[model samples]
Target: MNWYVVYTKPKWEKKVAEQLKKSGIECYCPLITVMRQWSDRKKKVEVPLFNSFVFVQLPDSDRNLVFQSVGVVRYLFWLGKPAIVRDEEIKIIKKGLDGTDSCEITIVPFQIGDKIALDSGPFSTQTAIVQEVNNTHYVLVLESLGCVLKMKYK
Candidate 1:
C-alpha cells in the first residue's frame, strides 16, 4: 500500500480523517497542540500539522473510497497521477508532532518571507510571515493585522 495525500476543505482535515476512519479507511492527520491565549485565560488546542492535507494509506483499489468522505477535495497529484508518499516519511511526521506544544521543535525547512499559520489560540488559522530566524527563537510578522510577534523556536 502507498500513502497518498488528499486535499480537504479548509479547516476540515480532522473531520475528514475521522469520517474516512469510520469507513475502515486508514487515515493519518498529524496534529499538534499549541497554547493559545484569550482575554479570559490560556488553553491548549489541537490543530492540523499541515492545513488542508490528510494522508491516507490505501491500495489503488481503495482510492475512490477516500473521495466519498465528506470534506475531501481531491487527491494531491503530480503529472496527472496521485503522488505516492513513503511509509518512512509518514512515520517521521507522526513522531514529530506526537506530543509537541510548540512549533519551534519542528525541523521543517522554512525561509524568510515564508507564510505560516497559527493553528490555535486567539490567532487560530491566522497566517503570518516569517521575518527572522534562529535556532531558539524567531519573529513572525502578521501582515494583515499589522502586528509583529516574537516567538520561541527550538
Candidate 2:
C-alpha cells in the first residue's frame, strides 16, 4: 500500500477525509488554526494546510474507491503518474504538527521574476511569473490566463 494525494472540491478537504475514514480508508487532511476576520467579528478557525488536497493510504488497486465519496475530484498526478507520498514524509508531517505549540511551514522561496507552474487549482498547469513577494502574499502574473493572481500565505 502507498499513500496517494487526492484532489478535492474547494473547501472540501475535511469532508472528504471524514467520508473516506467512515469507509475504512485511512486518510489525512492536515489542518491548522488561524484567525480569520469578518466585517463584524474575528474568529479562529481550523483550515486545511494544503487547500483542496487530502492524503489517503491504500493499495494501488483500491485507488478508485475514493471517488465513491462526494467532493473527491481525482488523484493528483505527477509526471504522468499518480503522486505518491512516502510514509516517512507523512510521519514527519504528523510529528511536526503534533509536536509543536505553534508550527510554521515555509514553502520553497520564490524570488521576484521567477517563472513557475501552478500545481493545483483553477490555475493548475499554467505558468506564472512572480511579480511581487512579501511576508503575507505573492502577486503573480498569469500571462496565459491574462490575469494577476494574489496568493496569501501564513
Candidate 3:
C-alpha cells in the first residue's frame, strides 16, 4: 500500500477522513493547535496541517471505493490520477506525528503578556512589549516612541 492525497470538499477534509475510515481506508490528517481569541474568551483550535487535503494509505484495489465516495473531490492530481508523494516525506511526517523529534512544542505567539527582545533593527538589542501579533508582522510598543510599531520577523 502507498500513500495518496485525497482532495476533499471545501473544508471537509476531516469529514471525508471519517467517512473513509468507516469504509476501512486508513487516513492521516495531521493537525496543529492554534490559539483563537474571541470577544469573550480565547480557545485553542486544532487546524489541519494541509487544507482540503487528506492523505490515505490504500492499494489500487481499494482506491475505487474512495474515488466513488461522496465528499471527495478527486485523487489530488490532474485528470484524477493518483499523485505520488515520496515515501521519505511521508516517513518524516509520520515521525513528526509519533513525536520522534521535538515537533510537539507549543509555540505561543508573542502576546501582550509575553516579553520579547528585538534581535535586530533600530530596536535591535532593545526589549519591546507585544501590543499585538498579526500576520507577517508583530505590533510592538517601543519604549522610545510610546506608540506601537510593526516589525517583520522571518
Candidate 4:
C-alpha cells in the first residue's frame, strides 16, 4: 500500500474519511484536544490538526476511485503533479498517534514576561503577563481586573 494525500472540502475531513472507509481506503486523521467554554459551562473538544485533509493508503489501481469520490477535492500536488509524502514522515506521525491519547491536551510554551495576545474571554485581544505556565494551561493576570485567569492554550 502507498500513502497519498487527499484534500477535502472545507470542514469535511470527517465526512470524507467515512466515505473513504466505505470505499475500502485506509486513512488517518490526527486530532488535537481543546477546552471549550460556553456562557454556562466548559467542556473538552477534539479538532483536527490539519483542518481539511487526510492521508489514505491505497493502491495505484484504485487511485482514480479516490479522485471520483465525493468530498475529495484532489490529491495534494506540486508543479501540477500529485505529490508524494515521505515514508519516514508518515511513520513518525503514526508513532505519535500510537503513543499518545489523541485527546490529551497540551500547553503552548510561554516564557516569563512574554507579551501575549489574549485569545478568549472578556479580555480578548488585550495584552497580559504570563505569570505561570503548566501542562495544558497557563496563568495570566489581567492587570486592570486585578484577577488572574487560567487559560488553555492548546
TM-score for each predicted model, relative to the true structure: 0.63, 0.65, 0.61, 0.60
Put down candidate 4 lDDT per residue, 9-34, tens digits, no spaces.
Answer: 98888888888888888887777778
Model 1 worst lDDT run, 10 consecutive residues = 98-107
Error of 4 at 103 (Å): 15
Question: Which candidate order results from sorting by lDDT in descending order?
Answer: 2, 1, 4, 3
User: 1 or 2: which has the higher TM-score?
Assistant: 2
Give candidate 2's error at residue 20 in angstroms.
Answer: 0.4
The TM-score ranking, best first, is: 2, 1, 3, 4
- TM-score, cand. 2 vs. native: 0.65
Comparing candidate 1 with candidate 3, which one achieves the higher TM-score?
Answer: 1
Model 3, stretches more than 4 Å misplaced?
Answer: 78-80, 103-154
Distance (Å) between predicted and true CA of 35, model 1? 1.3
Q: Candidate 4: TM-score?
A: 0.60
Question: What's model 3's TM-score?
Answer: 0.61
**Tens digits of per-residue lDDT for model 3 on 115-145?**
7787977768877788777788988877865
CA lDDT, every prediction? Answer: 0.90, 0.95, 0.80, 0.81
For candidate 1, the lDDT comes to 0.90
Looking at model 3, residue 18 earns an lDDT score of 84
Model 2 has an lDDT value of: 0.95
